[model samples]
Target: MQDMKIADLPVHDRAIDITGETCPMTFVRTRLALDSLPDGAVLLVRLKGADPRANVPRAAADQGHDLLDMFDLDDGSAILVIRKAGA
Candidate 1:
């Protein structure tokens, strides 16, 4: 795949790696991770497959978080950079 990640982005406040996790767990972990952050805090979430690539971002947006970027890495996984919406 083409390298489309943004070169300069906001520094993430935290990171969660859910590569081996599945649907509900993927989202659950993401939600919990976001909850730990204060407003405007950025999080870097590492996940894999089409499901996570699809669901996580949508769920984050629905919950009012900012989905800053989604990048597909050479490892066949992806990175979702999200900023917590409120304190």
Candidate 2:
């Protein structure tokens, strides 16, 4: 099948892989990754399973980043596009 990835959705500054993890863990990993990025940079988080779909965007919003977009793939994965807020 075609790779339905976050990159295929829209332009972003960076892409992060968190495919093998679950809920809170997925959120945690995304949070840590965002820390290293400069404000205004976009992060494309790729994760497999359900929790990432529900939780990642919520976590991103809680952390002050804008949840730019989200894509649910046919292969049972999700892509969340988030933009870090300026400090």
Candidate 3:
């Protein structure tokens, strides 16, 4: 198997923007969204700032989800791709 580029990933099952959110709220919102998803669903999280850029993916992975990818957008924010853990 080969690693897919961020652009090659399938369309996300859901997407949320947390560019206006900070720290714990960033992960909080992300967790809430993940909780709403079915097992193995993919989520696209749009976030800004160093805190969220670093924390959301780490926290999601810690909670047993898969961190597919994290990459920057041209506008300065970044996108985090996560796959919900199978139940």
- Backbone clash count, each prediction separately: 0, 0, 0
**Candidate 3 lDDT, tens digit per residue, 1-87?**
144365664589998999999899999999999999999999999899999998998999999999988877767888899999994
Total clashing pairs in model 2:
0
Residues 1-87 of candidate 1: C-alpha lDDT, one tens digit per residue: 455454443477888899999998999999999998889999999899889899999999999998998877778988899989984
lDDT on C-alpha atoms for all candidate structures: 0.88, 0.81, 0.89
* Order of models, best lDDT first: 3, 1, 2
Misplaced by over 4 Å in model 3 are 1-10
Tell me which residue pairs clash in candidate 3.
none
For candidate 2, lDDT tens digit of each residue in 1-87?
266544456787788889988778898999998998999988889888766787788778887899887777777776788899994
TM-score of each: 0.87, 0.83, 0.86
Whole-model alpha-carbon lDDT for candidate 2? 0.81
Candidate 2: residue 69 Cα off by (Å) = 0.5
Clashing pairs in 1: none
Best by lDDT: 3
- Worst 10-residue lDDT window for candidate 3 reads 1-10
